[model samples]
Target: MSATSVSSDRVDHLWKGVRAGVPIFVASAPFAVLFGAMAVENGLTVAQAVLMSAAVYGGASQMVGIELFGQHVAPWLIVFSIFAVNFRHVLYSAAIGQHVPHWSPLRKAVAFFFLVDPVFAESERRVENGKRITIIWYAGMALPMYCSWILMTWIGAEFGSQVMPDAHAIGLDFLLSIYFLGLVMGFRKRPRWLPVVLVSAVVSVIAYRTIGSPWHVSIGALAGILLAAALPPRAALPLEAAAVEEATS
Candidate 1:
């Protein structure tokens, strides 16, 4: 392709990515604002609240950190808690890493930096549709959400000083749980899903009763992950069998 056409294609790809990412960013905006409000409510300055949104980026980790900070917990413990909450990103990267083998080390690093939950979902959706994840496109999608998150954080910090009273109390913090549950349900048709979900839920309940709050969360997720990994994938049958299955369906 000519130089002009290449540049045009890059711009086209970027704009397409931005368009695709709009709904995700819009959906996540409330959580971004809430995080900012909580950060300031927990004694962080407005600048600090915005900075945390820009730097940390993980909603769960940021909330856990701010909550721990408010409780006067030790700094190391706070760091550990945040790490525990974000540990799943390691799995996310592992699962998707092979799709971008051609991405350079620096490109991979930059891409991973923007790999939040919604971003991961969109990327995986593209892969399922057999689309390639170009660098410019990834930037276009990620930047809008990333920038809006910081902006919303500032808005929350500036306005939440008085109104931050019952936001958390009214159960806004549970929004993430509902959002994630919906995502998990989206995969209910996948193979062996029932076993994995049942095992995970049972383990999580047991852990919640025994190990307690935060730890139970991770433990239950881990149990499901382990069960999924251990379960053998369904094998493809022969042509005759496949034909019969398709006929029945």
Candidate 2:
């Protein structure tokens, strides 16, 4: 294809990725609204709310940050905690490193800012055909998600708590467990993650109840990493093969 035709085709392919992201946006919207409301109620300013959405762009990590913020944790510690919670992004960078080899330094930096767990999960799950993925597709996904986050945060900062009465009694806490369980189940079709789930959950609950810190998430993630790393390569290879098959097929 001519260069112009190739560029156009790439744009079209990216639009498809954005369209595929719609369902995820639907899943994320309510949670973003909830986080916005909670952040504001916990005393974050509208600017802070929107900034975290724009800067952090991490739903779970933002929630954890706000929880720590509310607990009167030092700002530096809060920053460190957020970093620890999101450290897994480094692994994601390594995984996709070869795919986007020609990306400029500035482009790489911009892409990292918008990276979040769901974006990582979905993109990794559905990489396209022989055509190398372009930066435009990643940006397309970030654009809407970023807008929704800040818009929802602004709305909630201004009005969410007033409207969302007795939300605590409704037990949305269960949703966190449910959501994590769903993710685990999604990965559990393979055997390796079955142990990862069991060990991670057990480690998480113990850490949460004992060495309580907003940073407990880092501990749990480390537990999974350590356990997964320690698994016999022979035993883990089958699960890895299944995951690859699922991703490719």
Candidate 3:
């Protein structure tokens, strides 16, 4: 391709990623705002609140951290709690790393920083569909989401209660679960995913009731990983067989 054409393609990919992230951004707005408000309410300054959103972009962990901080929990315990909540990022990084094995160290570092759930889900979906993902494309998805989160967080810190007096009453908390469910459903056709999902759900409930807090997430994820490892890999369908199956569907 000509240089101009290649540049155009890159821009197109970036824009496509941005478009893919829009729904996630919308879904996350209320939660981001809530976090900011809660952070300030719990004794964080507006600067500290926005800084947390900017520096630590993991929403769940940020919420947990702010809550723990509010309780005057030991700093080490707060850090450990945040780490436990976000340990799943290690798996996400491992899975996506294969797609960019040739990336420079700097590029890899930047990519890891942006490797949040929505970006990972979108990028993984594209990869599964056999599309080539560029760094710019990934950034397109990540940067916008990051900006929206921080912006919403600041707004929440500054004016959350006035604007959203009852964020819970509006059911904002359930949006994340619904959003994640939609992402999970996208992989329903993958033979191994359903079993893992079911197993993870069961384990999560048991762990939540017993171990509680972040342990449930870690236990559930480990259970899913172990189950996936033990199961035989599903064989790929032959081209003709796949065509026939597609036609029947």
The candidate maximizing lDDT is 3
**RMSD from true fold, candidate 2:** 4.0
Consecutive 10-residue window with the lowest summed lDDT within model 1:
240-249
Ranking by lDDT: 3, 1, 2
Worst 10 residues of 3 by lDDT: 240-249
Compared to the true structure, candidate 3 yields what TM-score?
A: 0.70
Runs of candidate 2 exceeding 4 Å displacement: 1-14, 121-126, 172-174, 180-225, 235-249
Error (Å) of candidate 2 at residue 77 is 3.8
lDDT of 2 at 171: 59
Report the C-alpha lDDT of model 3 over 1-249, residue by residue, as the tens digit. Answer: 899999999889989888888987897898788888888877899899999998889987898788777778668878887887677577667777878877888998988997877777777777778987788888888888899999999999998668766767976545556645764575465457778999999999999899876567668978987998899867865433332222222
Which should have the higher lDDT, number 2 or number 3? 3
> Which one wins by lDDT: 1 or 3?
3
lDDT of 3: 0.78
Which candidate should be chosen as best, given TM-score against the real structure? 2
Pick the winner on TM-score between candidates 1 and 2.
2
Quote the lDDT for 26 in model 2: 71
Q: After superposition, how far is residue 170 of candidate 3 from its true place, in Å?
A: 7.4
